[model samples]
Target: MTHTRRDVFLGLGAVGLLGACANGVGGRGGATIDARVDATLAQLYRDYPATRQLADKSAGLLVMPLVTEAGLGFGGGGGNGALRIGGATVDYYNMVKASGGLQIGVQQYSHVLFFMTDDALQTFRRSGGFAAGAGIAYATPQKGEALAAETTTSLAPVIAVIFGQSGLRVGATLEGVKYTRIIP
Candidate 1:
């Protein structure tokens, strides 16, 4: 009986170790990752240069941090993100399939969502529409790209995401991450 108990304990210990490294564990490591995210954001902005300005210009900035999920063959496109505006950081999650702009890789970085128009912001905030169609503009930096740029052609609102952005420059296919409005 003692031996069996010891084995069980050992198994649990292994699981605990695995959880620490894995995403969504929400334990000490998860908290650490969040802190790291903040620091990384600082670095990203510093390296990229235009990131902070874009965030500041947006009607609201939604930050999706360290989403560590496996995308088997389909949608792992969206995960939980935070919406920051008026000094409030609201928690949110994304549930989208890419149609136009994205990369096909395991992305584990935070996303900064930029809303370049008032209508998109208003719609996102008031009409409760976080889904694409009404208003919003976004762009994601590639996994290696240092900078992502957008030239807004539509006054109707746009959401262009610059995905797979690391400190490197690699272009990703256009696959939009779906973002649903999080009820505050």
Candidate 2:
């Protein structure tokens, strides 16, 4: 199949629109992001109490209040979040993802990354852009279900919990998601 220049521009435009749907995109800076993070954490703890145990043990937590994703053939997602340590927001970040495949729909969800070790947290902070990879452990617990932080999970450098998903998108994964520190 032959592609035209218009097709390329249209595809790029769609991806840009999808990325803009992310929460806190044009919000009131750090304060707004922090507020959302607080609420998201509260809801997570309420829905899955066992996560609190993980939170308590974590060296730091990156709470992405809401991420919006959309795709037809190519897809992209974006969200703003805050990194909290000792229950206080220390820095803000932006999470972005780009992918291509057979996909069609839009979805919004919240996710949290728990830094189980100080070294992991430091590495993330120092890196120009940290990308989620195979090394990270993912735990998706159904509502009211317990998140078992077994020996293996507890020992993992980073643990991710995704929840409060709503929309038509079939599945959510952190693969290829890149997180960068942002002033907001």
Candidate 3:
């Protein structure tokens, strides 16, 4: 068999596309998403009781039940989630990220963003897309550790808690996650 550079590139592209599909990328509807959101929140409350305080203090929450990320020097991730206001799912959202760095492996995790202020939640919904920025506070769950949301931390406009991690990926960072409201 003979192959050219173009063929090699095309082959890589196909593999990447297949990998994304294998991650279960589409066809999630309202009922399915809401069920997952409910389960995810229950698990979070069970696993990290301290997070309950964070949730209680927030005006809204964006719950991403599963985010699957895979990388081989270049990386990408996609996940579907629900945005809740006043304890009801007001909208659906999809998160996607792309990055290039010295990274390899695959991981799956869940994350929730707490909008502490009505303004923050309003801004997020009004924007076409929202990106996690430096001003946001992060509370990564750890085994046998209590996520203490001090008064100052709770006062932050946006708070993020990442937990329920599985797979071989070394680390997960939210630097490039971009959230877009979706019909699902």
On lDDT, the candidate that comes out on top is 2
Per-model root-mean-square deviation over C-alphas: 10.4, 2.8, 4.7
Per TM-score, the best of the predicted structures is 2
Query: Lowest-scoring 10 consecutive residues by lDDT in candidate 1?
Result: 68-77
Candidate 3 has its poorest 10 consecutive residues by lDDT at 17-26
**TM-score per candidate:** 0.53, 0.88, 0.84
Stretches off by above 4 angstroms in model 2 are 1-11, 22-27, 171-175
Model 2, global lDDT: 0.83
Alpha carbon lDDT of each predicted model: 0.48, 0.83, 0.79
How do the residues 16-79 of candidate 3 rate in per-residue lDDT, one tens digit apiece? 6634663323565888889889999999999988888888878899999988777655567778
RMSD of 3: 4.7
lDDT score, candidate 1, position 66: 48
* Pairs in clash, predicted candidate 2: none
lDDT of 2 by residue, 4-123 (tens): 565455546667896656356455788889889989999999999888888888899999998887765566888899999999999899998876555567888999999999999999
